[model samples]
Target: MDEIVVGIDVGTTKVCTLVGRVEEDNSIRIIGVGIEPSEGIKKGAIVDLGAAAQAIANSVERAEHTSGVEITSALVSLASANVASVNSRGKVGVSGGIVDDYDVIRALEDARTIAIPGDRELIHVIQRGFVVDGQDGVRAPIGMHGYRLEVEAHIITALAASVENLRQSVASAGVEVAQFVLNPLASAEVVLTETDRQMGCVVCDIGGGTTDLAIYVDGDVWHTMVLAVGGNHVTTDIAHGLRLPIAQAEEIKKQYGHAIRAEVGLEEYFTIRPFGEDEPVQINRQELAHIIEARVEEIFSLTLQEIKRSGYDGLLPAGMILTGGTSALPGIRKLASKVMGMPVRTAKPENLVGLVDRLDSPAYSTSVGLLHWALSMSAQDLAPPRRRRMKGESNMNLDAIKNFFKRLLP
Candidate 1:
């Protein structure tokens, strides 16, 4: 039997779950998937515990049915607006000629020793690169002669209360939390390649209530940020601009909104019923597209400003890859390309079995990436035990290592 792992994406607009099995060759087979309308979340933060738990339960149940497997735990994506990241460096000395895994742990511990005030928790530690002795960019230093080992990493942090609340909500759904993967990092795993990162690329995940941005350079994440504005804001702008009910406005935006007005004809019109009016009113499609285009321009402008602030403007040879639900808006790529002055394309999850057709859309990238991430982590966890048995060494204590890393934070 294949070992199964589950991935849960809790977003402001939706909650999605994916079940995947790890193959012998380390590839992932997506066996089940589920999505449900989200409640109790605003701008990616859980506002009401009860509502969020119910949403998680609903999605998890659907995924279990589709996969025909029981899921007790999941690796979740963390995309709360409160999350932030900082870069840090650390160095350690290797006692023996060989650089073992323990030396790697010590280096990471040194990097995480920076002072952080109360109410913040370490979220993720991204390994940027390693320097062995005087040589840099060494991917692995194990079994190599090196007295000094240096590591540069980005330590992501988030509000402790918010994380605790999310954990409680998931536990309420009766699921064990295996790990939390950064949302944009997960998106990058599915959409970006080494060459794209080396050439500098920005991944914009335009979710329901938040837009998560991750800038990559030289095959490493340079910066990460989350904007509290997203598709929900567009819906609000349309509803307020068009004098329609919120539900009706969302329906109109989904069905008719376009991000570029130049492609729409001036005489093309659509009808929408006002909140109180019984008869539907006809409006020019260009007018609607113009409104949407304005908001989209503002979004891309802000995103450009963020990239500029990172000092990566004119450096991104690969330009940008847009994903998430908002990217599905018609002509969004054109609008983004025009405003950002760079090549823009939509990103989708690429590899999957049984659901390749369904997972081809950009909106499902994060969910699919989460599945891949869970499987990768599981494989890493299982490697040491198998290695020890082959080498006739004592059974390696994996749980101890996990606990050590966990305790290094708080």
Candidate 2:
């Protein structure tokens, strides 16, 4: 029997719900997709519970109707400026002079003992790498002979209140939040290749309200962050610059937006009627590009700043992989490379089968990645339990150990 999985991506500009089936070859077939305009969400946080709930409900209903499956629990995408990450090391003595899965879990559990604030909630505890005894860079320690084991972990957290609000909104839609995957991490699942992870790369997901980032090195996450500014800011700038309504400004931006001013032809122009103007006025496309360029530059500048702040800016030899809605903007890859002084490429879901007519853009990377994550989690459940004793001694379970190894592996 094929296993079914669902992912609900609650983004700033839209909410996408995807239902996929795990085929025999482990390929994901997109069986259902629901895309709806987001309401009551700003910068990835819920501002109005009722509006957000209705929007999620509508998206879920559409997916259910298309796939003939009732949605229950789903892996949800999350992004907010309140999200933060930290790196720490965990250590544990090998129980039987061999570093087993149990020992690895204990090490990760030790890593999770950070002093987080009361207002924040822990989301992910990803093992970056492991060390056996004093030897560093041990990728898999299970069955290795060692007296001591250490694991380096990257921990992500978010504001408790914001998470609860978003949770309540999904709950209202009758869907349980199985896990909250950060936006850039989800996007990285779809866009980043094995080489990108083994080398260094940054996943930049520019959505409507939030710009999410994740830095990877040695096939593990090193750092992550979410910026409050995104494409909506560019649209807002155009609206104010042209004295037009937000809707009109958004339309024009989509139709004529460019991240580089020099790339736009000076003779090209578009017509739009601003407030208090009876007739439509011809607006220079260069002017619109100018407005967009300023905002897009600032966005990358901020991203670069954050990358530098994380101290991993120099490690990214693969540069950046750009995704999300705003990444579809014309000339964005060149502009991003120019501003960040690094190679950049735009990516989206590829090699998709079944109901994938609309999932071919960079905008749906996170939506599709959630299905991959769900599949991995399902695999973790089928992993064989360790045969050794010590059943009640450890606080962590066998499933948690398998999951930790899943994250630890490339």
Candidate 3:
């Protein structure tokens, strides 16, 4: 089907809208791409709906102008900030003496039965793998004979208010919310190879507002997290340390930021006028690297901490894959390797075919990946044909559910 699909990545620093045309050969041709500076959003949460909606509209209009296709509905890449995850299992008896689609559906439904808080909304229920009877790791169990079937799934949830606010902003831009795909999951769709995933690895998407983490074990997501720290924090550090404007600090960080200070030379210098300064100050390049390295180290440190928290830090034989805007900084992968004590590499989308010059960057990983993810889900017909009765519930929908529910609850 030659369908036109759109994906809008609503980031804290930028809003990127991409329009792609699915060809007969199944290749997605990038017809349009629009990226605009984000406003009314902080830390991936919509703080001002009117301003955020205007930004979305601006991005969407640009894409429409370039592609000549009016977008009515689109998939969104959601930030993982305040996201919660858990692995769940569901089992059902085989019907008609064999495991069929209905049986598989029932198993998935059973897996999704978890105690979700009233303030949280379920976004994704991903099947990690399956089991037939007592045998495990069944990728496809349909048509297999078994008295019982079980499914292991990775469930992702987001704050309900956050999701609704984002939807309202997108609606103001005149686009219906087709689905909300997690940023890390979308990025993983295109960046992570089958071998990388099977061998086990971690994906760190260091964006402007938050550092998103995804750990893959046995070729499926084992853990997901969004840290309230990222590239913007690094910029803020530079701004404060150097006494420069946030914009200028950001620009210099893009030009000279490095994660390894030892590699920088003391003789190298960059002239910049600190905020409220009449004259420019010649600052040592190594000093700038020092400031940048401090924050970069923290980002990687937190990422490693999360991996260890997942109980799979030592299982990642494939090491870590770094992407996102912040991952583009120089010496990032090397620093990652040093900090995490594992092999590390920077990556971007490699599977998309079209006007791909801009999309082939770590920053656009989520934006381009959403195209592949959204279309794949559509083709798979992800929603079940019917719903079954839920099993016993427990408060396992998010990360502890202690603070989130307590704050929102009366």
Candidate 4:
């Protein structure tokens, strides 16, 4: 039987659910998609539990109706402002004078034993690299002759309350939360290339209420952060500046907004009925662009500050790969490049098949990337050499080992 994978992306602006089928050649066919406008979510956190749960349930129902598959459990995407990360190192003595899977796992386990607050919940422990004995920069320590093994890991955590709230929302929709994958990490699975990772790059996903940042160096995650501002801030600016309704402001921003004001012609205009106006008024495209440029520039400025704070600012030679709904704005890439002083490119879900007509935009990167994450996880579980074990331990069951080691990896 073909493997089935599901992913749910609950964002500030929308909730998306996707059902995918794994093909013989390891490609995924997206058989189902459900996208609905969000409510009771602010800056990627749930504000109203009932409303958030209802929104998620609606999205799930739509996906189930479209795909004819009963949804039970799925990997969900998370993007809360409470997200934070740290770097730690661990070392372990190699059993039997040789580094093996268990040795590597032990090192990672040790690295994960850092001091965390009572309210913080551990999310991910990604292996940055490994060092065997006196040797450093060892990509894989398995099978190498070494007495000691050390591993460097990047640990991500969030507020325990926020995580439980999200979990409850998904549960209310009748779906079990298989795992919670960070937003930018999930999006990275689809938009990033192997060369991009090895050469050092950042994945900047600017969604409605949050700008998710993930720095990848040496083919591994090095830093991650979530800024509390996003595209919706620009819309809010427009709403206040033009005295228009929030809905109308968002519409105008999407239709006429440009990241760079000078790039827009002064003569170009659009009509909108502001809150106090009796009839429609003519608004210059340049005027709208001006409002957008201010907010957009601030967004990148904040992003630049974060990159520098991570101390990896000088490391991103490959520049940034931009994705998410807000990235679709006109001239955002150009503006981001100018603000950050790096090469920027906008990306989306590509080379997709089956019910993917509406998913080609950058907005669905997280939704599509979730399926890819699931595929990778499934591959790891089905890998060979599963029977190999250390001489002392023979009591571990297959499921126990699978769960234990899977948590050790990303």
RMSD vs true structure, all candidates: 3.8, 3.1, 7.1, 3.1
TM-score of each: 0.91, 0.95, 0.92, 0.95
Task: Write candidate 2's Cα lDDT for 203-263 as tens digits.
Answer: 9999999999999999889999999999999999999999999998898889999999999
List candidate 1 segments past 4 Å from native: 356-358, 382-410
User: Where does candidate 1 have its weakest 10-residue lDDT segment?
Assistant: 383-392
Shift of residue 61 alpha carbon in model 2, Å: 0.4
Greater TM-score among 2 and 3 belongs to 2
Error of 3 at 237 (Å): 0.4
Q: Answer with 2 or 3, whichever has the higher lDDT.
A: 2
* lDDT for residue 78 in candidate 4, whole number 0-100: 94
Question: Who is ahead in lDDT, 1 or 3?
Answer: 3
Error of 4 at 366 (Å): 0.5
- For lDDT, the strongest prediction is 2
- Model 3 / residue 231 / CA error / Å: 0.3
- Please write out the lDDT profile of model 1 over residues 1-410, one tens digit for every residue: 78888999998888999898877787888788888989899998999999999999999898899999888889888887799888888799987756666676778778888887689878877666778997998766655789998877778888989988888888888888777777887888899987898899999999888889988877787788888888888888899888987888889988999998899988899998777778888999988888888888898899999888877787788999999989999999998998999999998887567655567777787888888777656645533321213333444454444433322322
Q: What does the lDDT read for residue 230 in candidate 1? A: 89
